[model samples]
Target: MNSDPDRQVPFLSYGFRPFFLFAGLYAVLAIAAWTGWLALHDMPGVWITPTFAGPPQQWHAHEMIFGFGMAVVSGFMLTAVPSWTGARRIAGTPLLLLALLWLAGRAAIWFSAFLPPIVVAIADLAHLPVLAVMVLGGLMVRPAPRNLVFFVFLALLTVANVMIHAEWWDFTSDTASPALDAAVLLLALMVAIIGGRVVPAFTRNVLVMRGPSTALPRSFAWLDRVSLASLAILAGLAAAQIEGPPTALVAGVAAAGHLGRLSFWRGMATGGAPILWSLHLAYLFLGLGLAALALAHATGMLAVSAALHLLAIGAIGGMTLAMMTRAALGHTGRPLRVVRPIAGAYALVALAALVRALGVDLLPGHYMAVIYVAGILWVAGFGIFSAVYAPILVGPPLPKNPPSA
Candidate 1:
């Protein structure tokens, strides 16, 4: 490692460094805990208390979305926003404080049963607003309109989180579901936004490095507008609980638009690289999940929960894993390539998504068995990831620039 006096502590030097590690570990541990709760909640002597004072299902959903999901989002935004807005990277004390706030929230929620409800609410809901402020601070430096758009979404997500806690505190009724649904849709929108930029750009870079010039991914401005607008409309309707054929039709349109949009991204070119292929597969899940969601609401042939899991476990989970691994390697001064074990990790998560999203219905008689298998695979995948990448995330970042591939 370079011994420059300017080099800060490894873990606190960059936002991605610590947050990625935490997210990976949380992904594994949270799922393992959730699985245990699901399997043994009814057992007479099981004392696995998450300290959630609300419905266990609500606790699980909230943790996955605001917990695991936001950590990855924080890591990504803190790293990527600087690149986007030409601002200095957040580091040192500020980053550490931000990370600590996140950890505090997780801990508060875990021990909520013992804490006063107001204290739990304050502790749990504090991270996102602070994150929004950090992000806005960066975006304000140069004020890129495109990048600044996320500030609005982040604020909205904060509201959604608070709304869920509101329901937990009996400040509202049946609001958690809609709030979570909105949060999920917002995350899907994020996948669309970030995935649109990175997938094709990364693919283009890889293809360029491999051979003679290849066709760059196509972009259609009009379709991009339509897709985003339709998604926003769908999210609004869902949050508002405006159930009708009209909302379903809007969702269906959005799904089709997203699917068609993904088709033009040249995902096929990414097949050779696990890093690239994983993202493509994850984006495919986003499209399929939207379609399934539309079908569920429109025709009732599929379960809404099932449809959402494709986005959750498949898209959000898959994409975050792919990004975490790729970013960890690249930022740590390593080759942007996956080894056998990492490749296996990707396959396990994909399998987990399939099992969790579909197998519950396919083998209804063996639902718990399917869930157990999915949980095991989910834990194994993230376990391998956290084990492999922990050192890289904690070590000094690379001094040299990586090759395009």
Candidate 2:
């Protein structure tokens, strides 16, 4: 339970260090690779074969959700659970092993075309169960219902992942797309749940420190409950592959509930702080994405892929980067302020989401161009994060006190 940083090998000292650092790097690398794949796929005489198993598009989708997304989730959960349960932190050797397992999964997926499908599946599937067990053990110490719910989230994510691999194993051809949808929804739910807790709380902390403030962000209320419940329902429907009016209805309700929930958080008041406003922006995407999704199903105006991109690029990407920056800084005993590059990174990611989600519709004549631009923005955003935060993550924490100024 000690809060002190382990100095011998700072990178392996805690879960957040290695996971967050690598997640940022992988975000840049993966997106760049995906972009490259897209650009070269159609060119004459350009025989760019994929290094990853499966189709390029499938690899892109899978890695973003399970690879990049899960890495951030792992980092956050591993770092936070100890504080939540007052249990021993997973540091040193155990942390390294867990991180290595995640890296191995990425490698297995990348080279899956050459490897045995069963071996690839086993390697890629191993990380989540181990992570779930580690998290469950910690939650069991305190056993609060609220905290224990995350264990359920982890378990569901594992199931969703298996569904994706089922196609590779030739068990089912139709499962991967729906399973990926379910996975995205699950991640969006995590964002909703976690952001619900932190955004308003962090905003209120900043507001309180600033001076007297009568209108504080609201606490967990009926709207929050409704938002989460509706989203959970939609996620279940996606997993079940239920389509038509029912899915649209639930998505509409979820959209309304989430946007309504956000209104109570007083996001407008946090405009002065990039660290806080970035979160608010990310939550906004969650609501907007659901709305787009509902419209896509109901009116057939928007592509479902477009809507999911909003959730993927904006909600998941934005929120994770925002949280990673804040946590990395705070845990390293540095200021909570976002430097200019990191703040620009935040803006680039939001812009990337907007472009990716809406650009084709807005500029129907230039579909490939839109994709390329969005990919560039995504790479730049996370590239900045990886470059800027690498030292902070790998280096020792700042001293608590120093000689007099």
Best by lDDT: 2
User: What value of lDDT does candidate 1 attain over all alpha carbons?
Assistant: 0.86
Give me the runs in candidate 1 sitting further than 4 Å from their true place. Answer: 1-7, 42-50, 210-213, 399-405
Please give the TM-score that candidate 2 achieves against the real structure. Answer: 0.97
**lDDT (Cα, 0-100) at 397 in candidate 2:** 87
lDDT of 2: 0.91
Task: Give per-residue CA lDDT, model 1, range 224-252, as digits (tens).
Answer: 88888888887898789876577778878
lDDT of each: 0.86, 0.91
TM-score for each prediction?
Answer: 0.94, 0.97
lDDT of 1 at 160: 94
